[model samples]
Target: MKKYLLLSAFATLTLLSCNNEGTSVNNTVESMKTPAMENFDKAFKSLGDPQNRPTEEEKKRNTSELSDRRKALLVPASKELILSLGVTESELMRKTGGDMSQIIVWATQIYMKKSDEIRKNIKSEK
Candidate 1:
């Protein structure tokens, strides 16, 4: 009886977790329609394609694109703010985790998303 009760409890918990996961996915998909999400989608797509993954050159290129976007969008004024928030140039470089090229690609995506938020706030203010 104890075993049966435990099994039932586990099943219930599993079902609840699955339901929550479904809801989260739905919400995430809905949220992806935003401009920031669109940029994220593009950045990730450009970086994560399997063909891009295998070649060092492609990976480096992707990282360069990300860094460029971060610079272009955020400009110099936001550098301190971004650094204070823990997304500093050094931190981003660290994120590459020794994979020199992949580091660049991922960091760019991170900054791009941040820039999108800043832009959104500016728009809201005006």
Candidate 2:
């Protein structure tokens, strides 16, 4: 009877823990978002949309047009912020090779680090 009681308690706790996992994950993700993430999301969205993608025909026949399109993928705000951080536009374009995902990753890392510094300074000032 004691063994049976312990088993049921363990099973109940396990089930309750499982139910909390989804909420915990969502809360964590929500808390992690910052204004800098907006730029990352915008670039990612433009890259992810099929309609915004360069066609295979364009890749083959109109490489210059494709390059221009890829360059344009970086929104002006993002471009300005990234450039202000001392990363040259050409260097970023070369590093990302027109991959928005890469740019998103790079920009998010830069922004998050800078944001952390700003927060630290604000707290220290207080």
Task: State every prediction's TM-score relative to the real structure.
Answer: 0.31, 0.43
Instruction: Report the C-alpha lDDT of model 2 over 6-125, residue by residue, as the tens digit.
Output: 999999999999889766755555455454455655665786689778778667785443344654665454555566667887998998785655665577677677657655655575
Error of 2 at 9 (Å): 11
State candidate 1's TM-score.
Answer: 0.31
Q: Compared with the true structure, what per-residue lDDT tens digits does model 1 show for residues 3-120?
A: 9999999999999999997787556555645454445446456545553443555456755344444433323333333344557687745654544345444545555676577557
Candidate 1 overall Cα lDDT vs. reference?
0.54
Best by TM-score: 2
Clashing pairs in 1: 63-104, 63-105
